[model samples]
Target: MKNNATLCFPAFLIGTLATLFGGEIVSAAIYSITNTTLTVRYDDATQTFSVTETATGQTFLIGGKLEGEAVKATVTGRTIIVTQADGSTASLELRENVPFVFVHKTLRNAGTTTTYIQRVVPLTFTLDLRQPAAEPRTMGTAGLTAPDRRPQHRPDHQQANQAVCSSAG
Candidate 1:
């Protein structure tokens, strides 16, 4: 009879070694922990990201995503709200009808031993925001009351004029 077990032993050992050393060697490797990791979706226009812990009752909002995490944003009215998108299942604390606000996050785990199996790092993120429209003010384009920076848009009416002329001619 052929001894297949001996032949497969080397393959099994390699797999075991890889599993233990792969992540240790690769510092930036992204790992998944079934129900671990904090994800947030941001509304850039509003400057907010909805934050939540997928496995726990923790939830919040942040101005941006962490360094390695992906973030997206949207703006509405005077307020912007963010949402955490990396998580498969998480609830956003911002109500569409409510005023704009931010929520901070802190990590806390109970007596569950499984909480230590962290494939993703959990960070205590605090959401601090700035308000530009805090007071009612007049807006102007050509005066001393200009903004710190200028907008970049051409005043050329070439496109509009061309369309009108073509249609008329």
Candidate 2:
């Protein structure tokens, strides 16, 4: 019986080891976007975030205790709405794969009359996803090291200038 007990214990340990090492591991990549006006950091594992609106020097954080997680964001239709604890909200309009505008609207009341004011700020930046084994690169210089040799769409100079002038109005 003593010999049988020793053999059973060894067999049990071997089975445990096999179970522990028999599975595949999956990792999530970190995604980020940075420019002169804004910076965004997102962790794919936890769906957490840390973002900064550099133009207004305001930082909005979420999903971590040390970072204060005071803001909550939700996507609705083509917009991402970020609401803070203080009741202020910033709405970002999505275009294609990027955000095109940040809009903030406020309602004010004076002398029994209510007025609504809206502010719109345009954002122009490319979303950059980090590769699992790659090092971080500087903003606006990610693809500069090895430029794409493929021909890109180049509009006619006169037509482009006319379109720009027309849109300015």
Candidate 3:
């Protein structure tokens, strides 16, 4: 038989909320955190983000832009660690669930006849105070497309500047 013991009021309490997202995210955020760490749970898989604090008792939740470019992100327990100088770190699992989004849009110029496209991709999620995170792969597969045949223009110049266009017909 399972021990049904809560005879007295417990001191440690954990709070949580159901996460919802719109705009550009279409995935669930399943991440966790502890006093010294933050964790992510996904389809039976697990990852942990790490954090170190000199103080205790007071819970905390921090958010920052995650830069996982040209690399695979791996989270083991509840705190994420960096290896060297360029490494950036953030903490989770203390105050409230957090949500973040990073959008990536891609445009393909096939055939080369039509030349103009613009794109915008958005990813969003709620960070659970404990074991809260969405799989990077779960990021919305969304985007906007705009193409410019003026490939000869500077990378920045390639961007359309309607403000500078003349209206002559």
Instruction: Report the candidate with higher lDDT, 2 versus 3.
Output: 2
lDDT of each: 0.29, 0.33, 0.26
Q: What is the TM-score of each candidate against the true structure?
A: 0.18, 0.24, 0.19
RMSD of every candidate to native, in Å, equals: 24.6, 24.4, 21.8
| Model 3 agreement with the true structure over 110-153: per-residue lDDT tens digits | 23244333422111233334533332222122332222221243
State each candidate's clash count: 14, 0, 39
Instruction: Give per-residue CA lDDT, model 2, range 124-162, as digits (tens).
Output: 233223343244343232443323433454465434433
C-alpha lDDT (0 to 100) for residue 136 of candidate 3: 23
TM-score of 2: 0.24
Candidate structures ordered by TM-score, highest first: 2, 3, 1
Candidate 2's displacement at residue 59, Å, is 20
On the 0 to 100 scale, the lDDT of residue 86 in model 3 is 26
> lDDT order of candidates, best first?
2, 1, 3
lDDT of 1 at 49: 40
Candidate 3's displacement at residue 151, Å, is 44
Model 2 misplacement above 4 A:
1-70, 95-99, 105-169
